[model samples]
Target: MEAWKEKFVSWFATSGRMNRAAFVKRFFGVNLVCMAAVLVIGSRVIEETGSVFASNLVSGVLAALAAVFLYSPMVRRLHDIGRDARLAQAYLCFGIPQGFLLGKVAALPPGSLGLYAFEAALAAVTLLFIVLVFHAGEPRRNAYGAVPGRAAAAQQTGRKKGRRLKKAGTV
Candidate 1:
C-alpha cells in the first residue's frame, strides 16, 4: 500500500520522463475512468437539474480537473519523447471548448470556420499524442531524469557501486 502510494505520487506530483509503455497505460487508463465519470455523473447532474448550464457546468468542471490531474504525466510523457513539456498546454487550450462543445459539436455547421479551426487543432494535438504513445522513449538518461524500467535500475546500481568505490578511494 505504501509502495503504491509512492508510485502514484511520483507520477502525479512530479514532472519526469515516462516511457512509452507506461505512458500509454496510464494515459488511457485515466481517460477511460474520466470518460466513464463524465458520462455517468454528468448525465446524472443534467437529469436532476434539467438545465443546459448545469450540464455544461459539470462537463467543464470535470474537464478542467482531468486536465490538471493529467498535466504532470502528460508533460513527463512528452519529455520522454524528446519533446518540449509545454506541449501539454495545448491540452488545456482545447479541453474547455471540447467540454463545452461536447453536445453542440453535432449541431455545428459543416462549413463553419471556427469549427474547422477547432477540429484541426484538436486533430493535430490528438495525432501528436498518439505518436508520443507509440514512439519509444530515449534509451539512456535524459534531462528530465534517469531512464525508466530495467535500464534505470542497471544505471542506478552502477552509479551506486561507483559512488561506494570513490568513497573508499578505491577508484
Candidate 2:
C-alpha cells in the first residue's frame, strides 16, 4: 500500500520517465478503479435526485479529476519515448470540445446528427488515448530521464535483498 502511494505520487510528477509497462499498468489499473467509482457514485446520485443530469454532473467532475491523474503519466510516457509531451494537446483539442458537446447532445432525440458528431469526436479521442498507451517507449533512456522499468527493478531487488539480510540479523 505504501509503495502504491509512492507510485501514484510519481505518476503525477512531471519530471520523470515512464516506460510502456508502467504506463499500461497505471492506465488500466487506475481507469478500472475510476470506472467503478463512477458507476457506483453516478448511480447513487441519479437514484437520489431522480435526474440523470445530476448524476452526470457528479461523474463528469470525477472524470475530469481522473483525467488529470492520467495526463501527467501520459506526458512522461511520451517523454520516455523521445516524443514531445505536447502531443497530448491533440487529445485536449478533441476531448474538450467533445466533453462540452456531449452534455448538450445527451438530450437529443435518437438519430440526431449532433449525437453522431459527438460520437465521432469521442471515438477520435479514444483512439488517440489507445495509441499513446500502447506505443512502446524508447529501449534506452532518452533526454527526459532514465528508463522506469530498469530503475524500478533495481530498486525492488535492493529492497528484497535488504529484507533478507535484515531477517538474518545483518543490516
Candidate 3:
C-alpha cells in the first residue's frame, strides 16, 4: 500500500528516477483520470451550460492542472532512461497545444495543410511518449538518484542496511 502511494505521488516530483513499471502504470492512470474529468466536467456540465467561456475556463483549468501533475513524472521518467529531462519540454509546450489545435482544424475543409501538420506532430509526440514510458531505465543508477524500485527501499532504511537487505533477498 505504501509502495503504491509513493509510486503514484512520484508524479509530482521531477528530480527522481522511475522504472518502466511505475511509468507505464502512472501513464495509464493519468490518462484515465483526464478522460474521466473531461467526460464528467467538460461534456456533461460545460456542454449543458452552453457557455463557451465557462466551457473554456473549466477545460483550461483541468488541462493546466493535468499538465502540472504530468510534467514532473515525465521528466523523471526521461532521467531514469539516462536522457535529459528537457526533452519533455517539446511535448509539454507544443504537443499538448497542438492537440487542441488539431481538433479545431478538423472542422476546417478536408485536406487542409494545417490539419495534416497538426495531426502529424501530435502523432509523433504521442509515439515519443509511448516509447519513453515503456523503455527500460538505466539498470544501475546513472546520475538521477538510484533506480526507483531500489531507491524506495533504500530510502526506508539506512543505505548500508538497505544494501544488506537487498543481498539477503528481503527488499
Candidate 4:
C-alpha cells in the first residue's frame, strides 16, 4: 500500500525526465484505460439511466481524472527532450474543448464539413503529440534529470576522449 501510494504520488510530480518507453507506457496506458472506461462504464450508465447527458457527464469526469495523470508525464517527456513542460498545457487549453466539440460534431449528418474539419484538426494535434513521444530523446542529463542508460553513452564519450589523449601522448 505504501509503495502504491508513492507510485500514485509520483504520477503527478513532473520534475524528472522520462524515456520513450516510460512515456509511452504512462501516456498510452492511461489513455487506453480512459477509453475503455468510457466505453464500458459509460455505456452501462446510459443503459441504466437512459440519459445520454448523464452518460456524457460520467465520461467527461473520467477523462478529467485521466488528465490528472496524463499532464505530468507529457511534461516529463518534454523535459527528456530538453523542452519546456509548458508545451503540454496546450492540450489542457485546447484539446479538451476540442474533444467536446468533436463529440458534438460527430452527431452531425455524414459529409458535414464541420465534422471533417474537426477530425482533421484533432488528427493533426494527435499526430504532433505522437511524433513528440516517438522522437528520439536526448540520452544525457538535462535541466530535468538524466535519462536511464544515458550514463553509458557519457562513459563511452569519456573513453573515446581518453583514447585520443593517449594517442596524442597527452596522458
Q: Please name the candidate that would achieve the greatest TM-score relative to the true structure.
A: 1
Q: Which segments of candidate 3 are over 4 A away from where they belong?
A: 1-10, 51-57, 95-103, 154-171
TM-score of each: 0.78, 0.72, 0.74, 0.74
Tens-digit lDDT string for candidate 3 (1-171): 999999777557788787778777877787789767866887766558887556555666666566666777788889988988777777777635643453366578878887677777768778878878668888898888788878777667787787899999998
Clashes of 4: 0
lDDT of 2: 0.75
Ranking by lDDT: 4, 1, 2, 3
**Can you write out model 4's per-residue Cα lDDT over 71-130, one digit (the tens) per residue?**
888888888888986767866665556534545786889888987877777677688578
Q: What is the model-wide C-alpha lDDT for candidate 3? A: 0.74
Per-residue error (Å), model 1, residue 34: 1.1
lDDT of 2 by residue, 83-154 (tens): 887766666555434433556787899898877877887787677677777777777877887787788888
List lDDT for all candidates, in order. 0.77, 0.75, 0.74, 0.79
lDDT of 1 at 61: 75
| Maximum-lDDT candidate | 4
Judging by TM-score, tell me the better candidate of 1 and 2.
1
Whichever of 1 and 4 has more lDDT, that candidate is 4
Q: Write the per-residue lDDT of candidate 1 for residues 62-116, one digit (tens) a residue.
A: 7777777777778888888677766787877776557777667657888888778
Q: Which ten residues in a row have the lowest lDDT in candidate 4?
A: 94-103
